[model samples]
Target: MNLERLKQEFNSKKKSILGALASGTDASPKGSVDKQIIPIMELLNSCPDAVTTSSCSGRVSVFLEGRKQSSTTSAPKQEHGADVAAAGGKGGDGRWLFVTHDHLSDDILQEGQDDAIFLDMVFGGIPSEPAAPRLLGQLSSETRYIHFKFEPMILHVLTETLDVANRLLTCAISSSFRESGIVSPLKNPVVAIRTMGLAFDSPVGVYDPERNMIQRFIEPSGLKLLARLTNDRFRENSIRIDSFYRNLLSTMEAPETPLESKQTRALRKKVEGINKGRGIAATRENRVEIQDPLEDGIPFLEDDM
Candidate 1:
């Protein structure tokens, strides 16, 4: 379709999706946009050329895979849009045991307990350990496994035209979303903003139905370390997201100039330094209060411009 027609369609779709979000009827598993990414989503949707289709503001999760099925037995169906793909299990049905977009709380950790017990608490299940191994003939029909995962932020956006998509992708990559790219170029162009470098996943344990327990592999200390690292990645993800927002805003305001030009980069660095000195990180909650020249009325000289 032509650019004008594409823009029209995108605008219409944007309105419908935004309306669904407001009404809490969006099809995402969470049923609404994450609060942390709301400002970014709003900013993109405000532009006539772009709208976000899906997004996750990053999360740490414990997932339980469905039971493995025999060749003759078909896998069970998944309900509630359970994220089987994210679990990477053979079974198509898997569910999240525990999930949070924010850093894990310290209360989840307890001294002198096995990681299995901690995981049980996290999943809101009674802590238990396997009492005895099943005999060969008494073995359960299927095996179930659980995993711990920390995923970085990911967003998919549809732009009215390829040029607009490219500009957005540039902003994403510059903000450390190295895996961001144009998913579709010829028609209905979609850009995926993401980074796999910060993703973390590890096998937690296997579940024994007979024993009603999870047998964990990692130690308690190991679990604590994982939580710490996941929280660190969360902070970095937030910083990058803020940078992407600023870069996009600059691109929108100065459409004729390259955002990465030496002068523009220097100006950006100066602004960042000022914010850092003031102990300010541009988060969605505080973005409106930030006084960047780009957002303020301050004008740039011809050379800086």
Candidate 2:
């Protein structure tokens, strides 16, 4: 019943994983392996394929060890000692193993079974897609554990994406933002999709590895900022969607406005600052700050990405 203990355990393990990856202690040469672990743990815990056996070589051995019992059963004992490395060794044939605390000590590992379940719920409960039908269902399930407002969380992710994309677009339109500034604002899509955790730069692409389809927004500007945002605009559309759900829990709670009206307002704002008829803001006194991460990164080049 102690939420604090559960939270502490989750935070500690999460930090440990992130630290291990960042420090190169637990990272794979391909990268994002650490990023993948949280979601994998979540999925397995959520809909566990009981005593599941999986192997890239087409056959796998399952290991179950814990506090309540002492046992070791190995079938196909010939490959019992298969190389279990986080990633490939120089031989380029390393197998991944998923181990739980069950095998260690009964008192500790038994107590940790609930922890694994909790971890599964936390990770598996993340909203991975912007357009999936199950997203609303997931949000409803998530509210049982965390105190987060679903509407805000939805906005947070969408706006974060939009902010990154917008920033990229802005940079592309102007010459102010640098190349390094173009680094991915959001990191791995899987973690964000699965756990709604803070996203960081991953060598991986925008979508989660488990999902083959591209996420909802495909615009170049949207990809860059899909992970970071500090404004309310990101959730504006989601808020409208939330309102239709009759959830009745709103922060800004603005009544839904027409899209044409919104676009007109935005265009008016742009034209108000135009130099003569050109719609570009030209304030010589206000120079763009290069260090501001929120600033757009898309270079104003003649060609588009």
Candidate 3:
């Protein structure tokens, strides 16, 4: 379905859960919810028990802590802490975001008198529910186009409902082991199909209307989508025919200096000077042998006569 219809479906489901919680009723017994509820439930399951510096991976949580300070100043205050170590700010922390496959089922089962509390337990904080249309605007097409929109919304609920400052910093790498489809090396291919972090103002929970950007990585077709985003021929980073030809011509005409100028000169001098060295050496014994041998033979012959 289109974006509008998908959003309506999510809101209706969300309101139902909130209503049940408000009325002090359990939405359902555990695991009795719709199939689309997996993402949110997984998000809930991923929350950390306490803050620690372990290799925790899940979804990052962003929230406001401490009492509200004086808001009467000219500049407003930020809700979430600002630091790279605190990568749980608004607009998401990094190039990735995730929604568990089992979010909705858990939300359905856990929406009780303490539903908000339960949500906080799952996500980091309860964000102000933005206007429905605007909220839809924040959800990327990859998420909206899903056959089950509840999956992503449930994930958002778990992330937005957490009572702590952060959640597990996690992600799902798509599996490369698909049977018929492209069997990429991805571990969790479908996770990429979900929308990324929602853009809002600083402080994590506040939904600023104009200051937001939505992003998503769709699997199976993600490469195609990426090609579209980066295929701008006019972009400088893209290959240019004219530039490539010009570079080729310049390289062809340029003389390749394999040896340095000093080395070439030294080699030439070495070759020329090699011929000037001594070819052979003569000794005085050769001259003496030619002159004395004749004199000795004449004297001996005269005596014999």
Candidate 4:
């Protein structure tokens, strides 16, 4: 690949990104694009083999998806609290009780609600969604929610070489964990990094107002701790991402191992980090220590994923 040509192309694209950012047209409901990675993005774009097309630092959201709603197409969360119920059914899509880039505070649980409250989505710069109180599934009026999407920082890099892409992906995976990220190869050649969070692809079982006993197992303090931990993990993931690209730029190289080798390395690194606090081997002889936290009294060991 022509390094100089790549740099020129990156510069052009970077210019457009900066222009759009300056014009305040990112269209993200949470806020303007994150300022944390702009410098890192600039540095990467200056390099010959990389250009960023889009990026997000991360976000935490509380939303309820309608039966027909697709995960990728859900509406933005409500910013104004007072109108959450009245406006809920108004929106054609799902509802968001809370959405933010920063970690939620302890007072989050204190947000008051009334009979089927709907959030207000009319405010400028706030993502707008039609009100729909029916979208939420809750049996008890007393129970609250701790749902969140702790997406870590994600980025799209247009690159020119397999070597560079593989190296970035390798380090990024190890740094963020295996499932946290992936690299997309394209005619334009893009490196897409997706970081993970506590929230899975789907919601936990919906509250059944008609039958299921309200799961009193959820504690406010525990939920708050979970939120805090998830938020902290999200930030930690972002830092890892930063370290990946920044180290690549400075060193101008990454390990040239096979994909699986890189994957194993990253996995081992993750296990090592986790086991720093306690000893539980996740690979080789002690691999079973990970898959099954406890063994039966029978003392039989089996392979599992």
| lDDT, candidate 4, 1-305, per-residue tens | 47667556656766776678668777656556677767767766666666666777766665543223223433553333333333222233345655666655544433352211212210112222322355355333322222334666767666665455555555555555343222333333566656433334223223222342122233334435556666676667667757665555544433443222534455445544554433444444564443222221111112110
Clashes of each: 0, 21, 40, 20
Best by lDDT: 1
How close to the true structure is residue 304 of candidate 1, measured as C-alpha lDDT? Answer: 7
Model 4 scores a C-alpha lDDT of: 0.48
* lDDT string, candidate 1, 1-305, tens digits: 78778778878887887787777786766766788888889888887778888889999988777755443443564333243333355335667777888987666654664676675655548354432444334345455666778999888888777667666666776777776666556665788888777898887667665666766665567767788888899999899889887877776677464334434455446544554554455453465343442342221111100
Candidate 2 segments exceeding 4 Å error: 1-113, 120-259, 266-268, 271-305
* Model 3 alpha-carbon drift over 4 Å, by segment: 1-92, 95-108, 111-113, 130-305
The reply for model 4, stretches above 4 Å from the true place, is 1-15, 67-92, 106-146, 180-186, 197-219, 252-305
- Candidate 3 per-residue lDDT over residues 1-305, each given as its tens digit: 45455445544555555555447563322313333333334333333221111111111222322222233423433444232112222222321122332212322333243444533432333222323445445543112111101111111221121111111111110111011011111211111112112112122222232334222122213322222322231132112222322332332244652111333334334422431221121143332222221221101011100
Please, what are the lDDT tens digits per residue for candidate 2 over residues 223-284?
A: 22222221222233233323322211121132452111333334334423332223232334
Model 3 TM-score relative to the real fold: 0.17
Candidate 1 similarity to native, TM-score: 0.71
Task: Give the TM-score of each candidate.
Answer: 0.71, 0.18, 0.17, 0.51
Best by TM-score: 1
Error of 3 at 46 (Å): 30
